[model samples]
Target: MSSQAAEVTEVLVVGAGQAGIAMSEHLTARGIPHIVLERHKIAERWRNERWDSLVANGPAWHDRFPSLEFADVEPDAFATKDQVVEYFEQYAQLIGAPVREGVEVTSVRKRDGGAGYIAETSAGTIEARYVVAATGAFQLPAIPPIVPADAGLFQLHSSAYKNPDQLPQGGVLVVGAGSSGVQIAAELRKAGREVFLAVGPHDRPPQRYRGRSFVWWLGVLGMWEASAPPQGAEHVTIAVSGADGGHTVDFRDLAASGIRLVGRASGYADGKLTFDGDLADNIRLGDENYLSMLDAADEFIERNGLDLPEEPEARDLGPLPADALEPIREVDLAASGITSIVWATGFRSDYGWLQVDAFDELGRPKQQRGVSVEPGVYFLGLPWQSRRGSTFIWGIWHDAKFLADQIGIQRGYLEYDGNGAPSNFVPRERPAVAAS
Candidate 1:
């Protein structure tokens, strides 16, 4: 830390991933003076943390910012991990975003006897009238400690997982049936390794349906506008893949392809692992959600009187694979020959440096849309922050725009009426937007 006086700015944006870049873009458009502080290189998680075989779940068109996109890749194709990172790098350069990389913010708090906030960082302290926490979603990977530490099985989180060869030579057990787990299981099975997938509550939507991508259908069906999850459907994840030109996610398909299907990993004791007994019901629910999505799409097409081809295979998912119906309740690790476990159980917020009283007990920010209870402090890039789409690339762009708009209101650069309509809005492009 520098012993000099604190550096001051009009706004300070944290984290230089998609959300931060998006926020920077909007601030630049509005000619607002701001500085973006990054803990590492831009798009660091996508560049280093993700698995080697990782690909965007959404298609390229849906996963890019409005101004820039990936070249040479098909619009319908999902971006590879490298491609996604490269895209962001190019986008940041093109937008001329003020991203000061390698500067990590350790603590952010209200300034004493001042009208704004102060961010303590590795470089020095930064004072700003407003701060946008765009640290992104994958803050910390959540790995449950269900199995004992001395269980003697090699285990790692999905964030640390790369290719199939990184694991031990024996079989692998992938817990959590979300996008990460299923993709890893599929990749391992492709590598001739016996894989056991622990199924959890997931909505297995296909990569495409009726001559359209699943995300396209969601956009058309107005499903992405949902600000909150329906009752009992909070933890459910859509398990579709965009690797190898995209495909549907089917546990039965995985089972038929030599990968074993099991229930959620519940406990392990007496040298035997136990799974939940509701495997059948879980599979049944996934099938229902799958068909219902297609049904809803079909109805939307019919209601709108659109000429589109129907996919017969999507309409009928067929019976549950016989193996999926049988729950693998308990299996001794030695007996099953399972040598490794991959916990792709998703992530949780890791905002210890954020010292504002705007978070829930679970460390989740308490906010409506991107605006927090704390004035001049905002959040971005959270799923369903404003809508379900807010988590996706373009959605993050829109969310960032909304946050920038709010900041614009605060900066007196714009104004909004009570109904949330902009009363006097002007976003000019002026050089040197950020002040000392």
Candidate 2:
């Protein structure tokens, strides 16, 4: 090993995505000396990983973090992937966030003698008083293990999908009927390719009800503030789309549009894809969840005495024509002329670089509201990190700010009053350092 000396800093933040930038903003505001180390360029995922026509699932208004709002874009409009990337880039510049791009962190471990943490990165070594893992929750794309390596089909995960033209001219099988799956299927169909979608349990909220957008209703109904996982309930996956004016996609609509709605792909058998026959049950479950959300919205409006118009009785769901609800159990890949498969299965967190015992039995970090049990360690941009919206762009600001204060307090730069409020804050006088 080279005898190079390790660089030192007060705080070191990994990943310069929205969460990292937000944390940098708070740290900067409080005069904390920190450097954000990003493995790629700022907003690299939105820039490279996402499809060309992808848009934010939430409206532009709700996508803003603290002290930064989408001024030029329409509030109700969904931001395209490019726009979202530009927004983050501009936000980083606006706040003058000290971000070092293309610095890949290899490992993070506690320093000897309880001094601090040492991070081994592509650049060199870095020792910091505190380390914040702001890599976000969607680190690794999770394709099902059942997908055979030698399936011989051109396969792409949703993160790698750009457009339909990239695939060979043949039928495409899109797995996982979440937001990514439905939207990608629509794009493939629009490109004049035959599409087959694997249906699963998901929520199908309409784009709008009455005169307001569904997101507006959710905001007004306090849905964003609800505690996530709901006190022992597993995290729910809602599959509403942001494309085509935020229309909801379901098996019925997809089937009506001439896209085959198959059951969840179970495995490969004898050159054929096996699937469970649960299309109808999945659709029924989705409808139940949709209706429950509507009821909750109605109750919120009634309880708060809001003068909103009644939901229109003629609300259209664009369901399938009576003949389109057939259950499909299997598909012969070769026989059906299928050439490409897109896995829209969700992502999982990969904290293999972390050398701390901060994870739970489920391999998730055991933290209370983003603060780790290990002092001076923290996490940001995790789903349900603190509340229902913790993972969303609109929610990370709160967690970032809170973690900044915690770091400040630990460094003796800030103190909490008896009422549990931060007071008498003072930033350190040392010159702030930024990684080159």
Candidate 3:
């Protein structure tokens, strides 16, 4: 084996996705010496995971990067996945962020000197004073391995779904009613193929409520405020996942469009998929619950004297065309023309490679805002990392700025306030980990 020397960075960023990119930009803005390590080409997942016909499930105004956005894009509209990726790419180049692509961080471990951590990557090892784990929530798609191999049916996860042409001409079974699942199902139905959407616990927000996009309300609600806690910081389960959480389909529109609503998908074998008998009823109930939450949020806004426009005034844009809805229904494989299965089952957060001791019971890393239990270690890009918008591209700027401040304090670049949290959570220092 060739011997490789270790490189040192003031801050080492893991993952080059949206969150990681934002961190890089913030560090650059602060004139902090840092490096970004990515497993794949930047934004490769978006180019790979999305189908061709896919559009942003929500409006595009709220889908921009912190302080920057798609120039001249339509308002209260959605951006296609490709458009989103292009925007990120442009943002990265604009910031001139130092990114080392195709380097996968296999593991991160604290050094014995107690100064910082060492990141072991395929290319080489990087010793850094701080490591920002910006791997987003959608790292691993949660696919249930229940289908039998003998079923003689094609199966692939949403990450592998390129386009409808990649699937067979027959009908398709889409399990998991998350954003990807719902969007894929709609596309399949539009292709004139019989599609079955297995209802799941999905967050269904109105596409255009009252007269504005759902994200507008979130912004006006201080959901994206910098002082708010990170997404998983609190044990409180959010009432709605919003656009980023799950499928934002309006069930009324889906049903009205002739989409076949079926029960929750259960075990499958012998090329046959089983679902709960209460699929239709459950879907109806889920829709009702979602609508109720929207109403409640609206009420809270009015009671608190928030700046939201009245319902009618807010949703002046009105919902998309009713025909814009995709038709769906439950169908048995042999009888239905569908010959493939696409699992849009959403993704689960995976921290298998992290050697840190800050994870909570739900496999989420513990952090007060972005500061973790470990000193010189932090995380961003989690669901609501610092507020409702923390995870969103537009929402991440404040978190990045806040994290930069904390890092500065830790490194003595910025002095810490008295009685505040300890500047260095890890005791003892070796040669000043972040020396210029």
- Top candidate on TM-score is 1
- lDDT (tens digit, per residue) of candidate 2 on 5-108: 98989999999998999999999998989999999999998999999999888778777885777766788888898888889999999999999999999999
Candidate 3 ranges beyond 4 A from true positions: 221-248, 256-258, 293-332, 360-363, 413-436
Each candidate's number of clashing pairs is: 2, 0, 21
- When sorted by lDDT, best at the front, the candidate numbers are 1, 2, 3
| Model 1: how far residue 178 lies from native, Å | 1.3
lDDT of 1 by residue, 300-344 (tens): 999999999877877666778775666678888888889999998
Candidate 3 lDDT, tens digit per residue, 1-436?
1157788899998888888888888788767899998888787777677677666654666677646767655756567677878877888899998888889889998877668888888998888989998887778877777776567788888888977888977878887766667777777777777776776554445555545566665565554564555344342222222233233465444545555656567776544666766554545545665566467668777797777556544233244333223323334578766588898766788877788887888887888877899888888877667666676677666677788777866676334456665554433335756758
RMSD of 1: 5.9
RMSD of each predicted structure: 5.9, 6.6, 7.5
Tell how far residue 97 is off in model 3, in angstroms. 0.7
lDDT of each: 0.87, 0.83, 0.70
Worst 10 residues of 1 by lDDT: 412-421
TM-score for predicted model 3 compared with the true structure: 0.79
